[model samples]
Target chain A: MEVTTHSAADETQVWGGGNKPLNASYGKMMMWFFIVSDALTFSAFLVSYGFSRFKFIDSWPIADQVFTHFPFLHGVDAPMYYVALMTFILIFSSVTMVLAVDAGHHMQKAKVTFYMLLTIIGGAIFVGSQAWEWSNFIRGEYGAVETKGGQILQFVDAQTGKRASIRDFATSIASERTTHQSSNGIWYQDEKALTTVTLAEVKAGFEANPNLVIRTQQLNENDQKIDLSRAASLEKIEEAQLVVEGANLIRNEYGNRLFADFFFFITGFHGFHVFSGVVINVIIFFNVILGTYERRGHYEMVEKVGLYWHFVDLVWVFVFTFFYLV
Target chain B: MAADAHKLEIFRGLLKFKSNVQKIWGVLIFLSIVTTFEVALGIIRPEFLLQDFLSMKLLNWIFILLTIVKAYYIAWDFMHIRDERSGLKNAIVLPLIILIPYLAFILILEADYIFEVMRNGIVSWNF
Candidate 1:
């Protein structure tokens, strides 16, 4: 509340023209400033994710169950393995990027070029792995029924205590169901693509199966979905309104549509960053090969970009924890 | 032109590296170990970690803490913030320290309140 005016000498001492206050170049300082702001943006996204998770705290889909598919290990419950591998890939790329920067410091042109190539390769693989993960998520492994109240009722083999795919039990019921286009229905409206199985068929299959029990989205004390008894399962099936096969912006076989939305938004955003980082790395790698930095007598560009690459890796560390581990 | 202007010590000088390249690899190995441990704990979901503490599972707390540790090394070592002057380090880190937790507290607390209202209020959310 008290205003104290400093002398002009004090002002000049602080401003002190021709001095780098933080002892960093203008470009590097700006990169750090950009990173700081970007970090805040990412934190906002993650904290909102936390908000949504807390809101649906009781019914949030278990990360273990949702992300169980591993590449080439189909039908096996290998949760977190693929994501863990992705994490390692991204981190390894960060290492190479930093090493490239270190080599740049020593004026080792060939070493910088070699490490840059490795970093680029690692980044490409990481992006590829992410694309595969997105595909698997979009094409969900097991299908579930969506109740009229938007609750997800997943099928489980009670005897085995494992997930049961709707395809395993859904009987083929011939029905005159056609996709409604603008020409067929109202000119202004069209139906979305239909799931492989219809609700009626799912209901009929449930009636025919004695071993299948319905697991509600709600979690019990053990942090697992609550599976209904046989009679309760039969009763719960009556409330089913639609068959959900995979994830999209609207809904998912996974419980809580918000979960899928956040997953797509957050990871998709991070993946875009990785994509751009790879592009940036490729450009820098080319410059390194062209001896541009060598002729310039410094490799500050590589160091600046290395900061960006390492920041990307840092974000993934948090994303991995919040999205998968926590 | 000594790039060794960058410090060689990490873990508060408990460990020191001979070269920047070796330090990069050291941090990489450390991060990998943290990630592997996180994945293992996630898969196991040990009985003790399931207990609720401070409105969250102990396992979740561990995950968040380890994640912060990983983030620290990535920023401080890999990004060369440890080599930066203290002014820049504070400029980069202090705001995050003050603001992220503040935002998290407010938003998460409100979310929990909404959850309570949805569970106990006149409107039935679960059918």
Candidate 2:
């Protein structure tokens, strides 16, 4: 690139490196490279997630059922609402970021600062909402029993199509319940959290409730979970070995542990990006407030960061579709 | 940087805004509307979309298409790709346009094979 630029300048020719290639500055060029590479990385993660979903096509958890909880609307079926809100927050932040860049182009430091502040706020809200979503995912709403072969068995009311939690039905036995700790099983390993309802209690509760049925993770032709009859439900409940309440690296109340694994990995990676983006934005925000870019003769620095901010928001569009909508 | 703030506009030649700020809001509104549509389709799961098309759900195809639309506007407008020269635009976008689908194809094929094996093998599904 340096050789071409030198020769091009000598001949009054155009194209390739040396200050500006196609009129893009060095910082902006490097930012574009970073964005393209980072986009590929995210594409790989999402593609692998798709691969896993296809592998477990019949048993993959439905996004609507898993992400139904909405803030301040507990117990109401609000599927896809919270995630939709998060997506809006991120895209809105991207808007502010581009607006900041626009203001920078005109050398309007005050507008840049105002828009930057709004961008930071939007990013903060998005990151917070993601953390909240993760917590809710980890602390699942309806507990299910995990079979010895690692399939999840959830209980639902037959009369109404709504889900039923173990806490609502399980009658606690006097028997002592314990999770694996250093003293219990592995001398060095410990379990995440103890399951509140024991498998035995869940099994006993299924026997008591005639209206309840067992819904296997396996989907029927209708693309819904296969509902087992009373007798089959009793038969299936016998194979229950452990109670799974939430999600973790090892187990998930949601069907197909791979589902939770991809959720954690992809969203966690994206969340880390947002966190770092927010940190970078705060630093630049201070610089804008302090007239640093104003004195630099140009606000190219803000434009470079704006590229990154928009890229993150762009990735979320795909993530929102792959993880939630699709 | 000599950035041209007004050159970047979204939705192709359609829906041109007078200023960059207005264009940003226009893109934001368009993106929001697309998202709302995606969410609504996801929840409703209409009968026609539920029917399998080309071995995939029509609804999923719609989601993917809308996602790509949102991604394009975000790149072309918010990231100022449209304001960039064609050379720079192609340099950044060409690699992704070529590579992402290739990776997706191979990975999805492998997963499909794996699923076939599981379905046909002696391995029990009741676990």
In Å, residue B35's CA in model 1 sits off its true spot by 1.4
DockQ of each: 0.86, 0.82
Model 2 ranges off by over 4 Å? A1-19, A179-192, B1-5
lDDT of 1: 0.91
Candidate 2 structure quality by residue, lDDT tens digits, B37-60: 988898888998887887899889
Q: Which ranges in model 1 have alpha carbons more than 4 Å from their true place?
A: A1-16, A183-187
Task: Using TM-score, give the best candidate's number.
Answer: 1
True contacts kept of each: 0.86, 0.91
In order, candidate lDDTs are 0.91, 0.89
Compose the digit string of candidate 1's lDDT tens values, residues A150-246: 9989999999998888988988899889888999868999989888888888888888989999999999888789999999999889988889988
Best by lDDT: 1
- 10 residues in a row with least lDDT, candidate 1 chain A: A12-21
| True lDDT of residue A174, candidate 2 | 79
What is the per-residue lDDT of model 2 for residues A40-77, given as tens digits with 9 covering 90 to 100?
99999999999999999988998888998888887998
